[model samples]
Target: MTSQASLSVTAETQENTLTEVFSLQKSAFQITPYPSLTERKHTLQLLHRLLVNHQQNIIDAINNDFGLRSSDESRIAEIIPSLQAIHYTLKRLPRWMKPKRRHVSWQLQPASCKILYQPLGVAGIMVPWNYPLFLAVSPLVAALSAGNRAMVKMSEYTPHTAELFKQLITDNFPEDLISVITGNADIAIQFSQLPFDHLLFTGSTQTGKKVMQAAANNLTPVTLELGGKSPTIIAPDYPINEAAKRICFGKSLNAGQTCVAPDYILLPENQLNLFIDAFTAHFQQMYPDFAHNSSYSHIINDRQFQRLQQGLVDAQQKGAKIINVSDFAPDATTRRFPIHLVTHTNESMLICQEEIFGPILPLITYSTIEQAISFVNQQPRPLALYLFSHEQDLHDKVLVNTHSGGVCLNETLLHVAVDDLPFGGVGPSGMGHYHGQEGFQTFSQAKSILKKGRINSTQFIYPPYKNKAINWLYKLLLR
Candidate 1:
C-alpha cells in the first residue's frame, strides 16, 4: 500500500504555504492600512517600468506558450493597453481618492457628511490562460491603485508565461506586497477559497461557478469576468466590405481566443455571399498565406484545439456548412488552425450552444433588424454586442432594446482598449466592472463618514414621555 503518512505530510505542507502567504499579506496590509497617493503612484510606475523593460521577454514567453502568438498582437493587445491603463489610473487616482462632500438635511443640523474611498485589505486574482498578461495584471493594477495587497493565481495551461511572470513579479516586489502563485486546478480551488477582502476571477462560466461557490464559504465578494457567445450584427445599410474587414480583423486576432471577440456574426439574408467574399478577401489580404504566416497565432494547446475540432465536427455532422478559409489542412503537430465559417446552424449544434473560443465563426442570417435583436435577446446576455450601422435611429433603437456589458458601434474589439470606458460582462458572461474609474471603485470601499461637533441635537429626542421640544422638533422635521 502507498504511504498515507507521506500523502498527509504533502497535503499539510501545501496548506501551510497557502496560509502563510495569506497571513503575511494580511499583516502587511494592516501595517500600512492605507497607502499614500505617492506610494500608489510609485507602484503603478514600477509596474509600467516592469512591462516596458521586459516587453521582449513577455512576447517571447507568450509565443513559446502559444507556439506563434503574433508579436504585434502581444504588443498592441497586452503591452499598450496595460501601460495605458496605468497612465490613465495615475492621472485620475488623485481625484478618485478625494472625498466628496454631501448636503446635510435640515433635520440633521450642524452635521457634515462625506464619502471616503478606502482600501480593502487584500485581494485575490485568478487569471485565465488566454491573454494571460493583460488579465492577470489589469486587476492587479486596480488593486494596487486602491492601496491593497494582492496575490495572483496564474493559469497552469500557460506554464511558460506563468513561470516567467512569477519570476518578474518576485524580482520586482516583495512577496507580501504582491505575489504570484502557480499551480493546477486544486491550487486554484484553494486560492479561491481564501478569505481575501475581494476576489476577481477571469475565466469560463463553469469554472467561475466553482470559484464563486468556494468564495461563498468565506463570504468574499467576487468579480467574475467570464466568457459568453458575444454576437456581432452587421446592419443592412453598412457596407459589406468594411463590415467584413473589421469583423475579420477582430476575429482573426489571437486566433479568436479573446474573451470579448466576436463569437458569431448575424448576417443580412440578402448579402450573405457578398459578406463572405469580402471577409475572405480581407483575411487573405491580412495574411496571404496563413500556413506560413508568423503573424497569425495558434491555438494555445492541444486540448483546446481538440475541443474546437470536436465542435467543428459536431457542427458539420448536423448539416452545418463549414467553410475553411485557408487551403492548408489543419495539422495537430503545427497547431496553427485556420478560421472556419459555419452557417445553417441550429441550437442543436455545439457551436451555437457553447462559447467558440477558437477561430470558428458562425454566420447566422437574419431577415430584419428586429429579428437580429430578438435573436440576441433570446440568448443569455453577452459580454459584448457589436452593431455595424450608420443609421442613428437604428443605433438608438438597438442600444435601448439590448442589454450587454458593452457595445461597439461600427467597430469591433477596440472598445476594451479605451481606458475611459468600463470593461466587464453581464448575466452568464460576467459580473462587476474593472477599468478606468470603475476599476478603482471595484477594489475600493466607499465608506460614508459623517461629522458633528459640540452639537447635542439628538438629546432633544431622548427617551421622554412627551417633551414639548421633541414634539415641536418632530413636527418641524416632518413638515
Candidate 2:
C-alpha cells in the first residue's frame, strides 16, 4: 500500500508544473493580445457541446454516487446551470472585461484614471461531490471568462464524474489553459497546499478550515463555500400550503443535501402541528412512493446514510418526537431512507448542532418571530435562511437584521436560481460569494491605472516636507 504522504507529494509536484504553465499563460495574456469576445463566446459554446456529449454518462454517474439525483435534477441543477452560466458570461463578459472609467480629482488635473480587470493567473478549485458537474462548471465558466488558467480537484466521491471531466479536458482544452486533478482526500490536501494565485473550495465547514489552512501557505486568496444549519422561519399569518410547498421543495430536492438547503424550521407553537401536517401531505404528493420514486434521491453512500441514521436515532433517544413523513410501504421501495422528524431535541444532540444534510428535518417551536431570530443569531451564520410570512414587515425586518449567505423570502432555496444574485455564505456558512458579478470578481483581480499628465508639476512635494510651495498647497487642500 502507498504511504499517506505519497499522494500529497505527487499532488505538490503536479501543482508546481501547472503553476508554471499558468505563469506562461499570464505572460501570453499580457503580450499575445487578450481574448476577443468571439473567442470567449466560442469557448463557452465548446464547453456546452462537451457537456451535452457526455450527458448520459453524467446522469448515470450522478445516479450511482448520490442515488437521490435524477436525470431531471442533473439536467436542471448541473447541465442547465452550466449552460446558463455560459450564457450569462457570454452576454456580460465584454462589458465586464472593459476597463472601468475612474473619476479624476480637480487636483489631478488633465490626468486620467481607469481600473483594469486582469486575470488572477492560475486558480486552484476544489469541488465537492454534491453537484459535481454544475459546481465544477459554474466556477470554471467564471474563471474561463475572467481569462484565468484553472486547475480543478474533483471530489473522490464521484469517480465516474471526475474521470469524465478528465476525459473532457484531455479531449478539448489544452492543459496550459485548464487541468483536472482526480484522487482521494490526500490529493485534495496536497492540491490545497499548492501555490495558486487564488483558490476556491466547496465542502463542509471542517474541510473548509483545512483548505484555508493549506492555502495560507501561499497567501493564496481563497473562496470557501461551506455549510451550517440553515433555518426556515414561518409566521402564523402565511398560507400554510405555500410555506409547506416551498420548504418541501427545498428539503426534498437532493434529499436535503444542498449546502443552502433548509436544515430546520422555527415557527409559531400553534402552527407547528398544522405545518407538519401540510408538509407531510406535500412530501407524499411529491413522492407517492418514496421507496422507489425515481425523483426522490438517496443519501450519498453507506457512511452518510449511517450518519443520518445515527442522528435520527440519537434524537429519538433524547425525548424528541419522530414524525414519519414517508408514505411508501417498506417493501415497495429500494431506498432505505425515510422522511424523519425530531421535535424537542436538545442543543447538544448531534442533529441539533451539526448540519443535518439529509432528508430528516428537525423542528423547533417559537412563541414569536423574534424568538426565532434570536435562536438563529446565537449560532454560526448559515449559508441560507428561509422565511415564510405574508407580513411584509416581518420579511423586511428579518432581511435587514439577519446575517446569512443568502435569504429565500417567503420560500425555500429558490433565490439561488435567480442568476442575477450572488450565491455564497458569510461566517460559518462560507467566506466568499460566487455567481454573477461575485463570481467574475472572485476569479479576477481589479488593477487600477492612473495616467500622468505630460508635464511634471509640483516637484516641490517629492523630496522634503519643508518646501513652502507644497506646504501652502497642502494647507489650502486640507483647509
Candidate 3:
C-alpha cells in the first residue's frame, strides 16, 4: 500500500478505538450516575494497591524509556506521589461528596436549597511524556474520586512506560471503568475530539491550544496544565547560598524536565556573581561526578537532547555567556548534557523566547524589585513563580503585583506536591486546575437543587389583581 493509504488506515483504526472506548465508558456511567462514596473509595484503594504491588515495574519501565531515568526519581516523583494522591482522595472524598446546604430566603420558606456534587460522566485525560506516571494517575485519582469513568491518552514519546501502564491498568480495571490509549499525535487528536464530559490535558502551550480547539467542537469543558518560562526571583536580603541550593534541587530533578521547574532567574544586579558561584557549588555538591552519575537522569531522547544543544548554541552565538557547571564533557553514548547557565542573554535568543524544557537556566539581572516584577508580568504567566525572600513586605508586593498559577516562597517545585494545593496555570501558561479539593470539583459538577414541600405561601399572590393583603405582604418582603 502507498504511504497515503497507510496513513488513512491508521487514522481509521484510531477513530474506531476512541469511539468504542468512549461509548463503553458513557454507558457504564449511565448505569451508575452517582457512584456511592464507598464505591469510589474502593476504586482508589485498588489503584493505590496496584502501585504498591508493582512499584518496581513502574520504575524500570520509565527508566527504560528515558535510557537512564533515575529509579529513585521515579519512586519519589511518580510512584510515591501517585499513591499519596489516591490516599488523599480516599480520605477527603466523603466530605467532598456531601451536599452543601444553603439558606433559603423567607419568601421561599418551604423550600430547601443545596448543591449536590455529581459526576460529569466520562472524563478524558491527556498525559504528557515528562513524569508520565504521575501526570496520568494524578488526574485519574481526581476523576475517580469524584465518581467519573476515565479514558487516558498516554504520550508516544514514552512508549515503554506507556505499554507498561496499559498492561497494569488493564489488569486492574474494567474496560468500562477506565482505559488507556496510546499513539502518536494523530491518535491524540482523535482522543481530544471525542465527546467526553470533561477533558484534562498536561503538555506544552502550543499543543494545549489545539486540544482546546478540538474540545470546543463537542462543547467539552477542559483543564490544561501547560508549560512556560517559570521565573525565580532572588531578593538581595535572603541568603544567596540557600536560594541557590533550592533552585539547583528543583532544576536538577529529571534534568529540569518538569512543567513547574524554574526556567530562568531574576537576580539583584549586584548579586549575580554570588548566585552563580553558590549555584555551581550546590550542584557540584549534590552530584560529585556528572559523566557517570546514575543519580542524575539523562535527557529523555535524542530529539530532546538536540533541542537543548541547539538552544545553547543559539544563546552562545547571540553573545550570551554560557557557564558549564560541571567539569565533565558531553557524552554522546549516555545522552547526558551538563547543566549550563546563560548570562547576558536577550529576547532575540530562542532560550529567552521559548520555554526551556531542559537543564538550561538563563539569568536576567534587575536593578529594582519593580523591574523584576515587571519582567515577569511582561511575559506569558507561568505555571509557577518562585520568590526567595523572608520579608512580608516583598512577599505582599510580589503577590499583589504579579499573577501566576501558583506561588512558592523561599522554595521551588514543592507546591505541586502539597496535597492541599491547587496546581494549574493562568493566561498563556494554561487553564483550570487539579490536585486538592479543586481537582475533585474539576471532574464533578455542582448541581443546585431546590426542594419544596406542600405549601400555600405562593398562592397568596396568584390573583389577577393584587389585593390589599398581598400588596402589604409584598411591601413587607421588599423592605
> Which one wins by TM-score: 1 or 2?
1
Q: After superposition, how far is residue 458 of candidate 3 from its true place, in Å?
A: 2.5
lDDT at residue 55 of model 3 (Cα atoms) = 92
Pairs clashing within candidate 2: 67-298, 68-297, 68-298
What would the TM-score be for candidate 2 when compared with the true structure?
A: 0.92
Report the lDDT of model 3 for residue 212. 98
User: Considering summed lDDT, which 10 consecutive residues are worst modelled in model 2?
Assistant: 327-336
Model 3: lDDT to the true structure: 0.93
Candidate 1: worst 10 consecutive residues by lDDT? 7-16
What TM-score does structure 1 among the candidates reach?
Answer: 0.97
Error (Å) of candidate 2 at residue 123 is 0.7
The global Cα lDDT (0 to 1) of model 1 is: 0.91
Per-candidate TM equals: 0.97, 0.92, 0.97
lDDT of 3 by residue, 123-204 (tens): 9999999999999999999999999999999999999999999999999999999999999988999999999999999999
Give the TM-score (vs. native) of candidate 3. Answer: 0.97
The candidate that achieves the highest lDDT relative to the unseen native structure: 3
- Report the C-alpha lDDT of model 1 over 325-351, residue by residue, as the tens digit: 888667799788888988899999999
How many angstroms is residue 282 displaced in model 2 relative to the true structure, after the best TM-score fit?
A: 0.7
